[model samples]
Target: MTKMTFRKLLAATALTGITATAVVAEEVDYGKFDGYTLRVKLIGGAQYEPLYARIAEWEAMTGATVDVLSRKNHFELDREIKQDIAAGTLDWCVGSNHTSFAPQYGSIYIDLNGVIADATLAEFQSLALENSTVDGRLVQLPRHSDISNLYYIKSLFEDADNQAKFEAEYGYALTPPETWDQVKDQAMFFADAPTFYGTQFVGKDEAITGRFYELLIANGGALFDDDWNPTFNSAAGVEAVNFFKDLYEAQAVPAGSLNYLWDDTGLGFASGTVALNLDWAGWASFFNDPENSKIAGDIGLVRAPKGSAGIRTGWSGSHSFSITETCDNQAAAASFVTFLTSHESQMVEATAGLLPTRAAVWDDAKAQFTADGNNFLVEVFETYAVSMSEDAFTPPLITPWIEVSNEIWPQLQAAILGEKTPQEALDEAADAARIVMEDAGYL
Candidate 1:
């Protein structure tokens, strides 16, 4: 038999630590569970691993062992969980979940409402809690929320020669973009391509699809009608698609952007090869660190730009934990999840630049940053807080979202690469999305 130790388990699972005293001091007593091993599958990445470190503290407190069953990225973990469902091998008690992926799991996860203390549930942002609930059941406890904002190289905008040339060409002073039209004009004005491009985007998979979806919404288009039929092939949709097409045609963004993911876009901006990037709050720390970014101290940010309809693009979601229905120790699993999302644990994550789900953590984290004299993160948290409360919105809570996204993004790529026209690509994607809705019984 393989023996498990806390270090071995954490390294194998790529998990991180949390603030044990803070959570334990506030929660229902975690009674002793000597020798009980709670198994879990978690999403793994550098930004996410720090919170996992606190599991050892939980083990020490409750005398329960945490056996991490698997550690993979969200996309890979989604596939693994689906396979586990089909195979009926959901032996793990807790799994990482997302708002966009939760509906597809149906009743696999236990309803967390009664399991978690009411006060604890009330502590989370109401919108975060609402998004974590599906079919009137709280299936998951949110860890952190996400929304995109613009990041740019401050030096470029401050360059006097570039500023004069930009104002002359676009009839506006050079500054951080305030609208999608300005983004386009500035991207064209700043771009040199190959060596350096004005901007880039997540080009394929759900990344690009999510980008298009939010832009479509901001452009006053809806993805579907009230009955769930696809309606995103409208004039507004055309305008959204045209935005990408124009950027690509002008070569203002990277040539390989269609193949890029979050890491690619994040690293591209850090490399100082891209002047502007639209990304989530998760990358805020990494983007400003001198060790990781070429333009470290020179970075600037603003809320995501507005579309023709005058609304800001604010595609959003949250990372969360769910207890599986098949678990033998539902109570223990619930306790573990609650402990992880507690105020102190959330502060640990928020300190590392992750956006916390708890409302108070926002104030506390901002205060901590301010006290530390970290003005960059201070502005970051403030900007994101406003967006989270007022501007953020999630994709339609449906099981077929990923499948539909998978079908739509490739068509977007073809159009951006000039292999098809914008209208043709959206028409094809709408047809595919129709089939997905039909099979999901929404037709």
Candidate 2:
């Protein structure tokens, strides 16, 4: 990608990342903008809403009102942003961005190197800032990082009958799964259809494409070779696709799973009808609350299972805030994002189980959880921390990522729904993706 002169690769601060130490929160000068109404677009979902509650404090301190124009999921927001870019209608000051999706926007967003104070940027974890950088430009501020870990029903594995039955059928003990094959076997064992399911996944949009990508990596397949030729129709790719297809065909997952997104799978597991769910840490508090979940006290968490190549499935990224180049209130916009990702702001999100981007919050939040006797959240943090460090990785950080994903996911669904064999569907998707890479000058 560096060989080309793409405007999208506006390198942010390409400096070596500095690790923050245990230091006092430096007071920032959030400049007053009285009578100023900052227009913004934000990512909205149950897991992401807690931090928005702090906007009132920023409004009071800065004397500016926040006018949130749109609050939707990432996929919908991506579509809307693309539309805005086409019509030259980026009338807002700030918008939500992700590591995987930020590259698609080109130079629409301002590089934040000098916009945010070096002190403020240094407070964040090195990895989060590194992922937020595009080619060379630091285009966004990291909000919270994300990686999936398996959440399952505790009692199911403890049930004596289940153990005996599973051992008799599969020649293994009934326990937390350690491999993808074990997960398939256990899911099939527990599923009763329409009432109970073995597992569930986000089935459409870039969500499924991401799920497939991680599994493809786990099965020892790369999306492209050194020259960026599409190679996902290889043997390992077929095996990964078959993992989802076989579950769907056997009714081990929800019948409507092909249309389900994150909310569906998260809520399904909490309802106690699903035996397992692979999900992010933000749902930890919600999943364990008796007021919101039927299986509140019966939950067990584990790292995601490994695949045929003995590699764990880990597709990772960060949710972030970005400033628009056209914003009339650039200073105010920078202040807003700084306030949003500040130590205090991140603590609010961390309390709700969202991984903090600011390094200090990790220790402080765990200490708070221990003081509060919230062992579940402590465990949740520990389990997720390892995955974030060891198993985590991002997809190709290229401008054509979402475009390629659009071509791949529909083909993924076709195979999952029996419209085509895995090999046939992947072949068609690979052909389409090759054209995308070629047009983008990666071929």
Winning model by lDDT: 2
lDDT of each residue in 139-170, candidate 1, tens digit only: 88999999999999999999999999988887
The parts of candidate 2 lying over 4 Å away from their true place are: 1-22, 32-37
- Looking at model 2, residue 228 earns an lDDT score of 88
Model 1: weakest 10-residue lDDT segment is: 12-21
Index of the highest-TM-score prediction: 1
User: Cα lDDT of model 2 overall?
Assistant: 0.89
TM-score of each: 0.93, 0.91
Give the TM-score (vs. native) of candidate 2. 0.91
For candidate 1, give the lDDT: 0.87
